[model samples]
Target: MAMAITCMLRHAVTTSCYENPANGSTSYFKTLTPVYYPPNGDCSDFYVPISIDYEQPEFNPKFKWTDSFGLQSFMAALTARASAPVPEQAPFVNAKQFKGDYEIAASFCTPRKPNGNEKKVIVATHGIGPGRTHWNSPFKPEEFNFVQYALSKGYSVFFYDRLGCGASSKADGFELSLETAKAVLKTLVKSVKEGKYTGKIKAEKVALLSFSFGSFTTHKAISEEPDLADAIILTGFSNNITGINGNGLLRSFVPRIANIENSARFGDRDDGYLAWPSVFDLIMNYFKAPAFAPSTALFTQSAIETFTLSELLTFAAPANISAEKWDKPALHLTGELDYIVCDGQCKGIIETPAKEMYPNAKPLQVSIQPAASHHLNFATNATGAYGVITDFLDAN
Candidate 1:
């Protein structure tokens, strides 16, 4: 079951179980008896070398934010250029292939005891927020942890930081395009399915899960390599280009050059990386009042990470494509009040993407979790969303 993978895992991160999904209360759902995660000796941390010769756009990362007006102008131009095809008339006008080994940090975990669903695993990639921790949150694990929920349901979880975030190797931000993101994810899927870590996930049935920005990368990877995963669940995202308020949400970031804004955390990065300058601005982009706890917001700020300029310049372009080549199961789940994706009303808007993006999902499903925002895991009603995710897995 060997594949195009090269990496070694580090010491197990969990010798003991920290949280149980059954601890939380929800009238609609119930979890199984808790099991010690990692099962005595299991691999947790990893650094995989992803080598790809991907074509990336050319851009001059020389703009300086002189004032708010300057920021608005830059955003407007960025959005405009992102929509244009490669060989864009002016900005990002040319393309060239950049290939190398990028060391990506990953965490793999499974239940100590096996069940009917044991070999089934979910490989998740996070959005622009935190890193892999977005799915395995630390502030309140019972209420916020997706890995715990999946584990209780007898499924393993493979989570990783994207190429240029967290403990992963940092490179020229412009080199980290959507294509690169797709390549990294595809390789990870093969690694998990082929049992790169342990026999636990080797040849296992895999599900690809993505949040917000990571959703597009998942969408692209599956389209290019149709059978990489058995099921696809895109949370905190949709292909509704018209309804998604990306510009407004991005402007709310008050995006600052990552190194300039928070030198302490992002100083290692260059001007090609960007981050939100304020905590509240990020809140407005992701959360809805009373739907989330204050501590959740604070935890999110503490975990915030930087994104790249190339990523921003290429995000909008993929919103227009559907997974036409895929004939497997697919689901698009999101929060009803996702301020960033739906502009605060996702009721009627969520259904359009089901037809447009995943028309070939053997039996495509869409779940609009009530009273939540883009950051579904951080919501007070998070487990409810997690239930819908697992239920889809259970059925498909």
Candidate 2:
């Protein structure tokens, strides 16, 4: 018998009902409903066939198993060398076409009642592993939905999975790289501008919002296009990666094929996919003493998705962002306790690194969530993060 896998994006309603804590009755609230666009309509999810060619680093098989104790020790010695600032490398000149056209899956949501500016839209992208689901919490949709918050503030949101993860097309994970990711994002932004997705909405003023690995892709894409987005908001990200307890976090991911007992949760995921061990959820996602209920972390672990090797490599690569060319409004928000980006404290008199990276941006802001972690949107203080984002968007 085939294993049963839950599709997180199956809901199609524009509103969700939440039980009011004060009363026993339930209250209906507007939520981000699933909507289909051109090409693949209600019959299937939306997908775009994009052909792109870019030079990418050849994959080294040895890097995959380098997380062992001995290797970790060896890598530790080279940490300083690895962290040494290096000038960004230029895009590969010997670019080759990716094996086949990439089919990207996207989800779109609009405010229940448009406040009249349909052209103003925000394009959100998720990090590695999960798809757009990372932007909102499924278990407590009413309380922890970023997309719904943005919609409630009157901005339509367009979010999708990168080529190799989530419901998007699958291929040799090695084939998905930063160059390809940038190409995919460029296409999506252009499509939105052209009103290709839905004839009903045309984007005139656009903002780019991204998390973790998605932020890296967005940085490269916006750098290349320059004017693709009018404003940018980067979450679960920082210019520094050396501070992260990488080796510890890396050990938590075992090859998906090795987790057969939990096959149903992973579904038919292919090789090159990394599965998160439930036992390490606390160390990996939550703080020692979490602010939210323990149930929230459990739900997050159960809903965790698989990540691709290529996506990992893309993020592991040295930062080669051309921020000097970014002349729009930009915001960088991360968690105070973001173990992955910050060594646990993202606050204080820390400089706005992006200001130096994106010197030309009209105005740049940097902020840290008080008691949050790498997964800012899912953290207990997620509302604070949302406030920072929406406030930045409104000001810009």
TM-score winner among the candidates?
Answer: 1
Q: After superposition, how far is residue 125 of candidate 1 from its true place, in Å?
A: 0.5
Model 2, span 94-196: residue lDDT tens: 4455546777777666665777644678888887655666665455655567877777677777877777655667656545676667777888888887877
lDDT of 1 at 354: 67
Tens-place lDDT digits, model 1, residues 260-310: 666656667766678876668778888998899876776677667788656
Number of clashes recorded per candidate: 0, 0
- Give candidate 1's error at residue 228 in angstroms: 1.2
Q: Pick the candidate with the highest lDDT.
A: 1
Cα deviation at 333, candidate 1, in Å, is 0.4
Model 1 steric clash pairs: none
For each candidate, give its TM-score against the true structure. Answer: 0.83, 0.77
